[model samples]
Target: MSHLHIPDGVLPVWLWVAGWVATLAAVTVAGRVAERVDVRRRVPLLAVVSALMLVAMSSEIVPIAYHINLTVVGGVLLGPALSIIASFIVEVVLALLGHGGITVLGLNTLIIAGEMVLGWALFRGLVNLAGRSRVRLIAFVATVVTLAVTTTALVGIVAIGGSGATARESGALDPATLRFDNPFSRGVFSLGLFSGGEDHGHAEREQHTVEAVEDEQGPDETGLSVGRFAAVIYTLGPIGWAIEALLTAWLLGYVAQVRPGLIWGGHWQRSGGRMPGDEGTVN
Candidate 1:
């Protein structure tokens, strides 16, 4: 829900550069933490979770301009360290596939990875507080809270990027009407093989591309202030968050029932105090 799909050149140079530096440092730390675990076993799980995140993020909910991010699910299964690595992998792939600009890959990775790490901690804490029998409920609550925090972070990043970072797309949502103005918009779901490729709303993007080429100075302020942008995001964010939370809760609950060790025991468990009934660290 918090994936920033802002195009290249939108973010200021220093901000994105800092994002890259921070992301590299995070990956390094995650790698060091992963060294204690059996990489051979964890690698496969990492691949699967990363693939799931990539798929979920590739498609957009046309109405809300939102996509489901399964970072919470990844966090629970892979734990924080592996989840960070997986997030970096997914964001890089997403950038290549045109889900977002390559320049913002590092920032996207950090935001999504933060969601994963925070969700992991929150899920563990809630389970400890409320008891493991309510795993699904714990997952739901954790996912909702994680998405809320990360979504706010997303808004903050855009704000920090200043007015130039505002997206200048045509599908402007009328805050008063609570409706989109783009006539080509279809139903809620829109899937594209490559997000930047020809699909639903391709014409609008093509027009924007031409306009961008004409405007040598880059994007002119679309009059979409940070406050209004934040309003639109907050307006639509909860719907996407709740949808994702339900999906994650069901998924984690299923995994917990079949493979309890995946949730309760892993590298994250080794780094912290173990939970009751945990069968030592595995993978």
Candidate 2:
């Protein structure tokens, strides 16, 4: 769900190129670290996580219009660096299948990577600082981090598409226009589409495109106020994050209790820092 599937011609060439470069650098660093950590042993598990992400994000849920990618869970299990690399690979393959635009791959990867890194960091910190017993806490934090990362990415999309500045100016012109009056509101509403009935709604949607173009052409071409944009992003981002956190925490807690060894990096047949079956070998 964390993965972004934005189409092409939305972001400027420079932004796309920059995103690609950043993703490449991040992956290269991750690869080196993976090698040092003997990540080959974990490749099979990571691959499975990657496959799951792809499948999970393939179907969209109605109303929300958002697809789910459990890359946060993957990051929790595989660590941030590996998670980033795994997601990048998965996205690359999905692009081939026409899941997302080829040009937006870099931006997509960056967005997903943000989720993985933030979730992994939050999960690890909570697990260590609060200790394992507080599984719920860790889950909550993870969920928040994931959502925040996602919202930030969404804002980036708006900024790239020139909607952010437009919204701000629209708000300045008419504060009512800034607020999300409808659940389906895609930023500013154009005046031309204020007619009655379903045709009106369709026209309103069409007007959004025209307004966006006009917004980009003016002196305040960016279409967003930086401060307001950031505020809106964080405000909206937390909602999804909280939900994910609750789900993740509950799932992880259950797994931890039933299969503690799976989470603590301990052997299944072991207790008190010793493997029960390896006693004879040690002797």
Candidate 3:
């Protein structure tokens, strides 16, 4: 729900520059913190989770104009430090693939990393309060809350970006319903999977769709105000969040049952090195 999908030269220079600086600092800190763990053992898992996130973020669900970000899932599996690193890698790749512009790379990374960190913290804290037995419920609640917070952050970033920080191409939003109209009508549920920006056909179709919407809506006075933009996001966001939360819950529950250490913290063996303050339980 938080993927920017903005093109280059859109956001102001100051905003993107600040985003780059902050992202670099976060990644540096994440690298240093990651050194405390036996990162070698988790390298493969990191790669897997990063790839999954890439796929999820690249594909837009047609109806809701939303994408599933398995960032919370990554956070649960890889923890905060590694998840931050993964977020950077995923955003960089997404930019290269034309999911969002290179200019917004840092900002996008920060948003996704926020989700990972928040989700990890919430899940851990909730587990402590509710107990580890309810892994599914904990993951669901954590995912929902994390997405809500980060989506609000995304809206704030857009508001700060001035008029250029629209969620998608101009006139794409149906102001009355605050939902993006689906240009693709092949199916009720469609996955515009990784069309990349290079798809000439898809690009043409998108242009036509925007023009058509503009003609139908007549003159647009809304002009992408924070209030209207936020309405569109909030209207669609909860649905995506619930779907993602369920997916997170089912996946985390299975992982917790089979390999509890990954979710609970540390390794199954004492030699694997435990995180500070973590209750390392050997399965």
Candidate 4:
């Protein structure tokens, strides 16, 4: 939700540049940790996880830049160190799909990295506090927290970008009353979300209508107010966030039941179930 739904050239150059610098630093640190640990077995899994994340994000849900961000799943399955690297890689690929601006890749990566990192930290702590019976509960709470934090960050970014009153007033989509013809809807459908047959005809109507409105509205405004930003995010965020949270929780619980070592390190080597030593190290 914090990925800056704004298209290219909207954000100030300095902000995006700083984003890239921060991402590069995170990547460098993650690389160093991966190398030092020599979790040789974990190397191959990186490709699999990255691909999964790419597919999940690429499949966008309509109206908002909302998708089932399997961040919790990624953070839990892949350690925080690897999750950071993987998130950066996923953001780079997203650029090719016209997901986010190339210049803002660093900022986007930072937001996603925060999600995974918080998810990982909270997942471990919740498991320790609540015990294994409530695995799903822990993941659910962790995801909610992650989404909350990310949404706040996104609001801050919009405010920092200094969006004007006009843009702020019209920028976000109204959930209670959705106007079919808007950039948000068209932008979402462009990614193959709604296609083919009579249902698509409705989509076309909205898309074309929005384009016409854009023509009538004249040049697009650059900035959006924090109110508008939060409006769109909260309106669209809860559904997807809840969906991802429930799924992440259930899936993690399932994984824990069958192969707990896949999470919290390979502690399964000693026995049948419930991770060996399940103690002394988060990873």
Candidate number with greatest TM-score = 1
Could you give candidate 4's per-residue lDDT for residues 202-221 as a string of tens digits? 54665675566557665444
lDDT, candidate 3, 1-283, per-residue tens: 7667666776778999999999999999998887767766557667888999888777777899888888888887777888889999999888887677898999999999999989989998898799988989999999999999999998888788855544435554332223222657532332333333232234455566556766776544334577887899999999999999998999899988776666665532335465422445453
Candidate 4: minimum summed lDDT over ten consecutive residues — where? 190-199
- Sorting all predicted structures by lDDT, with the top scorer first, yields 1, 3, 4, 2
Better of 1 and 2 by TM-score: 1
Which of the numbered candidates is closest to the native, going by highest lDDT? 1
Misplaced by over 4 Å in model 1 are 164-224, 268-283
lDDT of 2 by residue, 78-163 (tens): 67677779878988988899988788788788888888778778877777798888977777777776676577666766566645
Q: What TM value does model 3 have?
A: 0.73
- The per-model lDDT (C-alpha) reads 0.79, 0.66, 0.77, 0.72
2 against 3, candidate with superior TM-score: 3
Clashes of 3: 0
Per-residue lDDT over 157-180 for candidate 1, one digit per residue giving the tens place of the 0 to 100 score: 988885664454445442212322
* Model 3 global lDDT (CA atoms, 0 to 1): 0.77
The TM-score obtained by model 1 is 0.74
* lDDT of residue 162 for candidate 1: 51
The C-alpha TM-scores of every prediction are 0.74, 0.67, 0.73, 0.72
